[model samples]
Target: MTMAAMAVLPSRFIKCFSLSSASAPVSTLQEIASASPQGVAKVVLKKGKTQLFKYGSPMVYSGAVDRIIGRPPPKTGEVVLVADGAEVPIGWGLYNSVSMFCVRLMQLEEEASREPTCALNMERLLEHRINAATDLRRQLGLPSINTNAYRLVNSEGDRLSGLIVDVFGDVAVVASSAAWVEKYKQEIEAFINKVDGISHINWRPSVDILKEEGLDLLQLKHASVASPSQVEVKENGIRYAISLEGQKTGFYADQRENRQFISTIAKGKRVLDVCCYSGGFSLNAAHGGAVSVTGVDSSMPALELAEKNIVLNGLDSERITFLKQDASDFMKKAAARNETWDIVVLDPPKLAPRKEVLQNASGMYRNLNALAMRLTKKGGVLMTCSCSGAMTQSGTFMRVIQGAAAMAGRKVTILRQAGAASDHPIDPSYPEGAYLSNIMLRVL
Candidate 1:
C-alpha cells in the first residue's frame, strides 16, 4: 500500500502529493478489476470506425469519438475503453478530453489472448512495458559501454503513450502528459528504479501543456521539495553538464550515434556546425581531430556550456570557435568572405510545430540548407537534418535538401541517410514515429 502527503504549491489551488511505499508494491489484475467501476471510462465509436485501433495505433482524435459513457470521461487520463458502433469493446486507453488526442488506446493482445472483455491490468502492464524497453537497450549494450546517457523509455515507442524517461547516468529524467503517472508516481518510480544504474528520479512537469490543454495548473502540478537542477552526464566518452529544466530531458541523447558518425569523417577537415546548441557536433568534430571547428548559435547559455564542455573534454581550445550569431547570418558572412569548409553541418530549430505551417517551414529549411551547401567546398560533405516530425517526413526532408542543392547550383550525391539512435526505436506500425531525418551528401 502507498501513503500520500500533500503540500501547497505557489498557487494555492495546487497541492503536491508524495507517496511512500513500505515495500515493492506488486499490483495484480484483481486491483484493476476492483477499481474498474471507479477508474475506467467508456467510449463509443461511430459506425465503421475501427482502422486506427486495428493498426495498433494509440491515438483517438475528437472527430472519431462517439458519445462518452460512464465514469465522467476518465477524469483526464483515467483509463477508458473504445467500443464499436455495436458497443463491442475495441481497446482501452487513457482519456484527456481537452487535448485533440482525446484518448490514447492500448493494445490488449496479451490480456485478450487470455480473457476477452476483462478489465485493464494497468500496473502490471506498465511494469512489463518499462522492463521490455529497458531490456532491449541492455541487449544493445548501451549504458554498459562508455555512454552513460541515453533515452531509457521513448513515449509511444515503448507503448506507454504519455510517458518519457531519459536516463542520464544515475538520474532518470521523467516527463509525463497523462495524469495517470501523477496518480501512481511512486509505483512508476519504483518501476524505473528497476532499470540498471538508475537510483535517482526527477519529475519534469509541463506547465505549458497544462495551460494549452485548458486544465487548471493547480489540479495538475504538485508541490514538491526541489532538488539541484543541474547534473553532469557522459556520452560517448565526452562529458556534458546539463540542467534538468533545460530542453528535451536535458540534452539530445538521440543524436548519440549521429554525432559520432560525423566525428569519423571530421579529421583534418574544416568543420562548420550550424545551430550548434551546446556545441554537440562541434565538440565531437574537435575530438575527432578536425583542423578547425566553428559553431554558431543564438543562445548564450548554450555557447557558454559549449566552452565549458570543450575544456572538460580536454580538447584544444584554439581548434573550436563558438560564435554567438544567428546560424543563417553566420553562413551568409562566411559565404561573403568566400570561405568554404570541407564539412558543413546544418541543424536548425523546429520550424514547423504543426502540419499547417509546413510550406513556411519548408521555405526556411530550403534557405538554410542552400546556404550550408554554398559554403561546402567541392567534394566536401554536407550533413543536413530535420527533427520536426509534424511536418518533415524522411522523404520530404530529402526532397527539400535536393531543392536546396539545386538552388545553390551545386551537384550533390547522397552518401548516407540516418535516423535516431538505436535507443530511440521506431514502431513499424507508426512510421511517423521516426522523426529525425539526417542525410550526408557529397557536394560537387
Candidate 2:
C-alpha cells in the first residue's frame, strides 16, 4: 500500500475513498500534481463530473461534506473529515505530507475514542483490558503463586497503541508515548479512578518518542495523586516492593515468567542480577533458595527499593547484596576480582529502538553478554534478554548471544527459551508486539 493509503483512519472512512482506473472499472488516480503557484499539474482525482484539483493546487476537503474536493492538503496538522452525508471522521490522527503514510490514525472512531475526556468509555476500555488480562492470568493459574504484578495493557497488543499500564499491588502506572493518548488525559485519569483495587495512578509519557513525533517535550500533564509510594508485591512467591514512580511500571512485568524460570534453577547457587532494577530476579533467586544473591544497578533509588523488597519478603538480607554501579562495569569488576556466579542475569534496557542502530546495539549486547558469561561459573546459567523490537527476529538475538559466549571462551547450551509473560500477548499479524526475548543458557 502507498504511504497515503496506509494513513491512519477508521476502515469506514477509508472505505469511502474510491480509487478509479481507466482500463480498470474506474480511474483510481484521482489526480497528482505539485501544489505551488508556479508548479506544473501533478495529479488529480475525479468524483463524478467534477474534477478535484490535487497535486498542483493545494488539497482541500470540506468539513461539511467530508469530501476531498479542492483545498491544500494538510502538511503537518491532523486530518479531520467533516461529518457529511455518509462520511464521518472516524478518529483523531497525525498526518505527514512527506511520508507515504501521511495519515496515522490515532483512534478508530471519534465517538469510541477512549481518552481521559471520555470518562465513561475510557473506564469501560480499561476495565475490559484489565479483566481480559486478569482472565488470562487466571486461566494460566498464576494466582496459585503469590504474585500480583502483571501487565494490564500492552500497547498495541490490547489494541490500544502507545498506552501501557502496569499494575503493582493497588497502584497503576499509566505510560503514554503517543499524543493521541496524551490528548485524552482527563479520560484516562477518570477511568483509572473507577478501577477497583487501584488507589494511586502515576503517568509517565515516553518523552523521547513524543519528540520524534514532533510533539512538545513536556512533563506528564496529569499529576499523580497521593498513593502509596511503595508497596510489597509478590511474583511467583518472590516479594518485591515496587515504587509507583519507578521506571516502566516499577517492576519489569515482561520478565516475570522468565525470572520464575531462573529461580527454579537457582537452588543453592550464587546468582548475579545485573541491571537488576528493583531486584526482580535477585529476590526470585533468593526465594528459590539460592546460596547468595547480588543485585547490581546504577540507579540508587531502584537499589533502595530492592533493599526494601528484600526485607519485606523476610529473606536473609545478608544473603542479598545491592551494588550501585553500571551493569557492564560491575561485571568487568567482578571478573577482575575473580568473583563468579553460578547463575547470571543480564536484562539490560533496550539498546536499539530503531533499525538503523541495530549493528551498534548488537555489538553492545554482545559485549554485555560476554561479560555476563565470564562472570558465570562453568556450567552455570546465563539468563540474557533483548527487549528491543528492532531486534525482532529470534535468530538475530541468538546469534549475538552465541557470539558473546564464544568471545568469553565458553560454549553455551540452551536450557529454555522464553518470551513476554502471558498478559503481554503477541498478535499473529504484529510480530513487533513480541519484542521481549529471554534465553536461558548454560555456559559449558
Candidate 3:
C-alpha cells in the first residue's frame, strides 16, 4: 500500500484483546473473536494515543503502549497486531522489546483489508513496500543515465523504519538498524535482488544501533563478501569512486541535488568545500567552470577518492585541489591569513547523533559556520549543512546559523533552504526522517 494511505485505516471492529481502556471499554472477548487472528499478539495503545498512529506515525513508542496481549508475549522482530485502546485492530507491526520503539507499524487496517496478500505478512509486506519505493524512484527518474547512484529505501521516509537501501551501480547496499530487518536479512536481499540493476546485495548493519535493538553484536556480519569493495558510479554526469568499506552506505547520495546546485553558481568562483567527503561539491564546482576549487577533509581516503574523481571526469586538476586537515583548523587559519572564497560549502558529519547532545552540537555548528563565514568573501555564498536529525527536527538550525552570523560579525541573507534529494523523500508524519539541512546564505 502507498504511504499516503498507510495510516488512514479506521477501526470498526469489536474489541478483541483482553486489556480494556477507560475511554473505550470492552464487554466480552467473544465480541470481536471473528476479527482477531488466532495465536497472534496484540499491542494495544493507551487512550488518545491511537490518533497519532492513525495519522501515520510509524513508530509506536513503549510509553504509548497500554499493554500487550498474547499467551506467550511477542518476541522482538515478531509481527504483532497494533490495536487502539478499545482493542480494535488498527494495523500490524514488528515488535521490539528492548528498544524505545515498541512497535514499527507496517500496514494499517484498511491497507490490510485492501491488500490481504501482504496483510500481517512481513515477507510479503517487505516486497510490497520495496516495490512501492522502487516505483516512486522510477516516477522520480532515479538511476537515470546521468545518475545511477541514489537512495532506494529511506527508512521511515519509505514507510520501512530502521532500514535504508542505497543503489550504487549494480550493487544494492542495505543498511539495517532494526531487529526485524536483521531477522529477515535473506528475504530482504531476495527482494532487493529482484529489483532492476541490482546484481549484489551488500549488508551493512548499524552494529551499535542493533545492540540497542537487542541484537547480538558477535553474530552480526557486515558488507556482503560477494559485493565489491569499490564501485564507480555516475551522478549528475560526474563519475565517482565509491568505497563500500567507507562511511554510511558508501556515499552521501542525499546531497545529490544540493551538490548539483553548487555547480550552477560556481562559474569563475573560488569555491571551498569543508568536510568535503569524496569531493562532491568541489568536483561539481570545478565542473561548473570555477576558476579554483579547494576541498578540505580530515579523511585521507576521501581526499584520495576526490582526487581520483577529478581524474575520472577528466577535469583540469590544476583548477581543483584537495587537502587533508581538520575543517575548523583549516578555516581558522585561512581566516587569519585573510583568505576568502567566493563560495564556501560546509557538510559536516553527525555532531548530534542524539537529542541529548543537541545543545553542544549547536555550539559546534555555530562555531563551524562562524569560521566558514569569516572565510567567505563579501556578498559570497555559503552552503552549510547539518545531517543531525536532532538539529534539523528541533527547528533550531536556522537560529544557530543566525547566531553564527552574529558571532562572525557578518550579516547574512537566506538564499535557499533545502534537504535531501528528490529520491530521498520525507514522510511528514515522521519528522525525524528529515535530517540533512542544506541552507544557502549570502554573507555580507
Clashing pairs in 1: 16-222, 16-223
Clashes of each: 2, 37, 0
Of the two candidates 1 and 2, the one with more favorable TM-score, higher being better, is: 1
For candidate 3, write residues 86-175 as lDDT tens digits: 788888899999999999999888776677777777888899999999999999998899999999999999999999999999999989
Q: TM-score of the candidate numbered 2? A: 0.72
Error of 3 at 176 (Å): 0.2
Better of 2 and 3 by TM-score: 3
lDDT of each: 0.79, 0.68, 0.91
Model 3 is weakest, by summed lDDT over 10 consecutive residues, at 13-22
Cα error, residue 416 of model 2, in Å, equals 1.2
| TM-score-sorted candidate list, best first | 3, 1, 2
lDDT of 2 by residue, 1-444 (tens): 575765876776666554432233211111111222332211111232112111111122222122342345543433322211322222333443333323333333323333433222344554565566556656766444576787767776765666788878777788886655676667666765665567778777888776655566654445646768677777887777777667766678888888888778889999999988888899889988999999999999999888888788888988999999998888888899988889999899989888899999999999999999999899888999888988855459988988998899899999888889888876554465778888889898
What's model 3's TM-score? 0.92
How close to the true structure is residue 129 of candidate 3, measured as C-alpha lDDT? 92
Ranked by lDDT from best down, the candidates are 3, 1, 2
lDDT of 2 at 416: 88
